[model samples]
Target: MIIFPFGKAPAVILVAALLAGGWLLLHPRGKEDANLVLWSFAKTHITAYNQALPALNHAYPDVKLSVKQIHFEALNRRLLSSFWSDLPSQPDLVEIEISCVGTYFKGPKEQIGFEDLKPRLVESGMYNRIVRNRLATWSNRGGIYGIPNDVHPVMLAYRRDIADSLGICVDSLYTWDRFIEAGRRFTVEGERYMIELNEQNVGSLECFLFQRGGGYFDSLGNVIFDNPVAVATMEWFVPLVTGKGRIGADLGSGQNAAVLFYKALEEGYYLFFICPDWRSSFIQEYSPRLAGKMALMPMPAFYPGGRRTSTQGGTMMAITKACKDKDKAWKTALFLYTNPEGRSRSFKKTNIIPPFRDAWTEPVFHEPNAFWSGQKLGEMYIGLADSIPPQYSNPFVVLAKGKLSQALVSCTQYYSVNGSSGFRDHIRKALTASADEVRKYQKRGLIE
Candidate 1:
């Protein structure tokens, strides 16, 4: 989760960018007119942009786009360095991942790196149709800097065949307590587990804390890791990995963890997954034979009827302030993110949930997902989209996530050595230490 913006360059990336750039230069299409350039870290996103190229070209006729794909960390460095160096090698529009968006939206509107997009959104009347949190994440000081490309609402994916054979009604387990009860029953024998407790990736902890209206920092820029809600969340979560309710197997990070998880998934060693819409690609690529056996459902509420969803990942389209032609840049960004036809096409191919509310009504959104037992997953995910709470956007998210992951790993080890009597205090102590660590970065003006 710590996105290092500076790193050693990869040789393959340089070669690929050189080849792609050479092709763009050799092609003479739209060379005499307005050229709108974009930069991204994903080839799939560039492919999606190509799908909308014809429509965008027909609408504006004079506008042409050239999208460049590079390393993710390199893109962050390019964006930040462009702001200081007056955008010498930057794009008119750039793709900002959710983790790095906060860094670009800092300070006053006039002093920021990106253009304020609030007026354009309000002018087109599209502001009301997009999810509020999606806009809020890329906004600072009441100025919007980006358009949300997708809404990553998280859900619980379970193996329907396993649950049914175990005589467990997934729908009936709407609360965390009920889900724990079912997990206990599912793991009565020691051959399988209910879920994998990923200590290396603390995303599940973030999801729970966000659902309970708690986060690393509050809206007022104060660290709130010591809040009662956060305490209770850790209290509830730690027990699932230790003692009697040890139904969650610990999964580490890197290729070994991925290989183990895939093996467990394929062999039916784990029965549930907590992730967002993007996880479908992982299933299809790794466990294709298990198609139709998985089913999507709302995450179990922390309390009865409480919020059941949170977000995981996102990509926002931002217009750099260095762009000379702001109007053309906005047109291209808006078309790619908000146009019904273009967004529908991307969703059909990538399974990315469109952030524009109107796009939910498109015919493609209603189509059944064959991988999930023909379920209308688009509708199910969109239903809980509005309920997602806002995260504390700050440049320190990388630091915070790293600290929390370490804390979770430490706490898990302590519980294994000791017992569950004072485990809650251990987690609270670790969180307090993390809050203090973040405070040092805040004092240094590394975050605000």
Candidate 2:
């Protein structure tokens, strides 16, 4: 069980490993054979495919599968680069990170990118079994290009030991207002605060955007940075970053960020950390000394009766249009991801929250986790999964997100100096200018 690092080494190792061992596979693909190649960066994803091979051979004797590991950013670039060549070396299947799926889906549809899986899904009678909204990440122009592998629902993780010591009832903090009030009470000089902020990252902003039913784009694929919902979300989050609420708003990235995050946990600098369910293993692996001290809880809603959870990270598997054996590849990919046994193995190996609703009925999903002092995390994850609002992204998301982050930083800085008056207009103007820049790319066909 190799817990992935939270630093920069993985990309370096991914390149070195791939360069040293070129096109390696568990079993050789015979010439003109029924072999399928999958490209991914996460070892757990590869492990799931490897674990399903035996069953795959038994069920469909001719289906052989292999995995190629590449750094995530490099993989996206190579996938796009393959589109320009007539005889390019392309994998049969590829893993599309949630954030990068837009790049593939945005271009002209006839450019020969990924295979549309909607027909195969309907033919297998398995289309409806999948959580439909999970397809949003990979869908464009009514074509669904990928099968989602995990549902990364966000939640709030707190230190149970600290909560008890401070006599705070965390379970009762059901709204952001209540949660912030609790933070005020939990603050102590020379001790832990409520949460640590990272200005270099806009994860908190994205989480709130998803929860408020606003994203980088609307359902029609138009950029909406200056929408009222977006402006309101930024307005709500600015104070948390700049105000004296036990939040560190200037955390750096790379090794410095990793060291600062680990130090915060090791030295007990905060009380709550908001992230996806996978952060459970991340914390367990990085801060092993904090075992049994932390516990999971639903995120506080923006308003009463509002959504309590929103999604963050996800990976979807898509079959390439260039593959020789499309039918065989579709069958292999579907079996590896949607089969009950395969889903079980993925959960055991990766600790990812599965998107298939039926998998929640298994006994393993009810077992208590010792890492958080016997918290029933599986049930909690499933419960939160039901309410995750639909998320939409555009090919311009990377640029738009940068604009939003800058808007946040500017508004925070201004509020820090001049207080909240006129902050709303400041953010609106900055965000509108950013949207105008994105519109130029849209007109030039850089993004759809």
Candidate 3:
């Protein structure tokens, strides 16, 4: 069904030449960027940006932005490699998730791939407009690398239908002691649990540790995972999830973790989760049937009149040093992040509270919804957002969390064999070992 206009040999030669030319184009060693590019790993963020792109276009028709989504790990790898190589393929702007940003800080301060935004932020007077605690996570060695995307303040999301049916007042459960005591009454053998907790889930445990003025590192970047508050928290937390009467249940893992956890919640296997604001939207999407039955409250403190909130995950926007157009990149990011219209639209799409204080007064943050049993979720989140503590971002944060998880596992195993009779001393020794192990890796060079 084919006919060659010329002889078969000439036609074949023409096609081969075209193929070689295409290969050269694709295999080029280096080339100047053709347009302003933003590389983001999260599709939700991309979708939100797309929704607000028209506004961006209207504001600056001359500034063109091409948003692309790359796989999380692959993007992080490419970012570091391109940074080190100073490759032309590097994007002008990039979105760095919390877990990935720390690796960028592994090198010396001057060698960091991202631009230090402190001067720009301060000069524009926008630094004070943003939440201080959220800013801390994107900072390293006094350099603020990126702008925070959300506050990610932690709260207690519970199954209110279950609470109401059992005649329990969620508001009265204001402290961990009361939460644990209340949990024991309804946490039946297998029918229901008081909360989503596991000794091995490092991030959630880190949330608890963070709430009490304790975490993996101090302001000086030293390992403090074995600090007094952390040890005391472990002593109190371990007994709740172990033994035959455990009130905590594993939330499962992998890409479908939220779906799996929500399914279990619908089945009444669990009653609570340590919810960040972004997670509230996921709950709405994955567990739609639970609408009107769910409610959120500030996290219970260790004791009465104590810190009532914590922070978990975060993301940041940065302009890579490889960029040739820092001015245009900054304009684009500021519009996408701080503009009132974009902030409102982005929050509706993702339920991620904007970290900028000016945007907090938006109408969306004050709206009440039946989804959360009429709780003004955004207002509550913002009220606690300013109080959310600082977590020092570091290369060893991930390693420290992993080591702490291992320590928790060791404590659980020891408790299984010996019970809680001597867990206080045992946990202390285990955490000390964990801190020592992380220190070993901290001394080793990560990139070399």
TM-score list, all predictions: 0.89, 0.89, 0.91
Residue pairs with clashing backbones, model 3: none
Model 2 deviation from the true structure expressed as Cα RMSD, one decimal place = 7.9
Off by over 4 Å in 3: 1-34, 254-257, 446-448
* lDDT for 242 (candidate 2): 70
For all candidates in order, the CA lDDT equals 0.80, 0.78, 0.87
* lDDT (Cα, tens digit) per residue for candidate 3, span 1-448: 6778898999899999999999999998676433689999999889888887888989988777889999999999898898888788898899999876788998678899999999999999889999998888899888899988999998989889988999889889899888988889889866788998976777667888899989888877788989888899887777777876678878567798767787898888888889999889988888889999999999998889998999988899999888888988998999988888778877777778988998899999989967899989899999999889898888887788788989998988888778888888998999999999988887886433
Best by lDDT: 3
* Off by more than 4 A, model 2: 1-34, 189-191, 246-250, 446-448
The order by descending lDDT is 3, 1, 2
lDDT of 2 at 336: 80
User: Candidate 1: minimum summed lDDT over ten consecutive residues — where?
Assistant: 2-11
Clashes of each: 0, 0, 0
